[model samples]
Target chain A: MSATCHPSDELLVAYGAGSLDEAASLLVATHLALCPRCRAEVGRIEAMGGAVIETLPPSDLGADALASVLARLDQLPGAPMPRSPVVAAPGLPSPLRDYLPASLEALPWKRLAAGIEQAILLQARGIRARLLRIGAGIVVPEHGHGGMELTMVLQGGFTDSGTGYARGDVAMADQQVVHSPAADGGETCLCLAVTHGPLKLTGLVGRLVNPFLDL
Target chain B: MPDKRLAVEPGPGAERFSDLLSAVAQYGDRQAFALLFQYYAPRLKTYMRKLGAEDAVAEELAQEAMLAVWRKAASFDPGRANAGTWIFAIARNLRIDMLRKEKRPEIDFDDPELVPDPAPRADEVMATQQSESRVRAAMSGLSAEQTEVVTLSFYEDTPHAEIAARLKIPLGTVKSRLRLAMKRIRSELGDDQP
Candidate 1:
């Protein structure tokens, strides 16, 4: 099914403008793989970039830039060979395939709590992207975000404050939102999450577990 | 719609570029490729420069972007995107690859699991003919504050938080401006079809 929840227009604009950092871009790209609506939105945004480029006063290239490009053009094949299609792990999106193991069961999952496990896929420039697997019917500790956090469900589903997010649904949280999310019963819920800053777990349980978890 | 049409005349120049790219794709026309290089290379250099590349690196990347255009010309679909939009995407992707150490994960069109958009309407197909001009018209309609944010966000590598700091505005304001700007642009493009 097509994704019902999407990243905000602001995020999609950043993705189209090439301004989003690598980890965030990976998350948004994976969502775009399942979302045609956002893809169309990004197409319009890129067209705006083209329009802006057309209006910019030209800057002079090196004197022989055109000649240099022409020289190299001759060496290229008349037409580029069609790229071989990428083979993603079953049930995994293509964008995530490279960063993950062949299957979810093989991931180097580190336990964060009795019912929670995570595998960090990438971290850079204060941003982190990871995979979270929550045991069925488990309620994650209530937490507030330090900055923007984006979570997209890859398998099963979760409910936050009475709202359900199924596969391909994105849940965005920031400093203002604090809630405990519970994975639905009958299946382990797997999610790909990208965060810009640290997450602050609240309450006594959170306080006890917070220091031990490196999230 | 009439006012938008008046604001920006249909870009004959844009259509011409599309033809030139098609010629390169169909027959590997060197002269056509040269014309494209002449128009886009310097602008692309400016794009790289605005993104913080020094002059030499910018020049090199611009050349690389143009070379990519030639190699990938066969993949260019004039029915879906005009030449400027197509080249912009190429240059944007090249900049990401060369400037950033991290990989930019992209959707593979040929992936078996890929979901496709619903079929387009006839009007939507016709809309591609003047998409660049329509975008220009849409851009002109944005407020100055919205335009400033959009321009910086597109031309610079600055993130939203950095843009907020640079402009001395709150991060929330920056996001709102972008959201409003995109809403205006979308409405102007008549892209609100369900």
Candidate 2:
């Protein structure tokens, strides 16, 4: 089935072009695993990418590159092994299964506010990957971003800047965007967020409390 | 929907590349691999440079990707993808992996996400194979402004904001142009068909 809310075309193009950051690529792949139409789209983009490479002029790889590769072929394993299919939990997407803890409830979550919790998974030079859980009916602090933020909803729904995002929807925000998100009252919301930089909390109260918010 | 002018005719080198991969897969033919290595290593290096890799890094990555092709040749299916497509996919993944490696702690190479997806359905594979030259033609047909952003995006790890800064265009403009360009390409390649 196609996802109701999908990643922007540019983002998918970047992913297919292999130019997106690793964290962002992971989320995109996870979404692709669930949505067959997007997978087809990315597949087309990748094929086009390969064709683009074919038209470029060649570069030199030095004298003994082939000889070296030939010499090593004898030392490696016999045949290429097929990749084992990932057996992920019910709600967990295949791409994310390896990085996350066994189950969502088992995650080492830290309370961020009265009804919000977060668990960081990976942190690189300028990027951070984490899971956020907001209890139903809770409103998150209004905030902007220092760079780009991609939040993919895993469960339930959240409304941000007048747009309602349900499960499998990704809300992409950047420096120009500032908004508060509130979890739908029907169920708790779970989101996987990959941010390139720190989020700048907005509003007077948000500014006063920004220093205390680690996320 | 097929464009007669955009149909790709497989040349001798393309056939040779495919046969060599099959030889490597079936018989562990070092000779076949050496031939592939000679042709692909240099091309891959050039490809890497086009994607913004510096000289040494591109050279290193090209070798690494070549070695991977040798080891994984058995996994390649001529029915699914051509030699150029298969090899370039390897190079692209390796480059992305290097980017990830530099930032995070060492990644588990065995991570399932890193694995290639199963061969696409037969109809989709046919569509992709047919669309190759058409996609090329569509890319050439893009507006210069659209081409600039698309090229930078395909070449570097620049985010939308950085692309905007480099081109001195608004971020919204960059996104809109890219979206329009992609839409056109998709239409040209017959990707809009159900």
Any residue pairs clashing in model 1, and if so which? none
How many Å off is the CA of B115 in candidate 2? 17
Tell me the tens digit of each residue's lDDT in model 2 across B30-136.
Answer: 66676677677877888888767889998889989988898788777776566766787788888877844532122223454332334445744554453446556
- Model 1 C-alpha lDDT per residue in residues A1-215, reported as the tens digit of each score: 88888999888888888888888888888888788778778878888888777777678988888887888887876654544335435667677776876566677789988799999999987899999999999999999998899999988999999989988889999889998999999999999999989999898999988999978
**What is the C-alpha lDDT profile of model 2 across A1-215, one tens digit per residue?**
24567788888888877767767877777677656556656766766666667666778766787777777777877654443335444666656675676566777898877798998877777788888999999999888899888988888889887888876778899789888899999889988889989998888988887788887
Angstrom error of the Cα, residue B8, model 2: value is 16
- Across all candidates, what is each one's fraction of true contacts kept? 0.71, 0.45
lDDT of 1 at B80: 67
- Candidate 1: which docking quality band? medium
Superposition error at B144 for model 1 (Å): 2.4
**Local distance difference test, candidate 2:** 0.73
Q: What fraction of the reference structure's interface contacts does model 2 contain?
A: 0.45
Measured by DockQ, the strongest candidate is 1
Per residue, candidate 1 scores C-alpha lDDT tens digits across B1-194 of 11212222223345578777877787787777787888888888889888899999998999999999999998887766778888988998899888986577777766666677666556446356337777787888999999999988887685788889989999899999998998887788745533
Give each model's whole-structure lDDT: 0.82, 0.73
Model 2, stretches more than 4 Å misplaced?
A78-88, A203-208, B1-23, B26-32, B51-54, B77-81, B99-131, B161-171
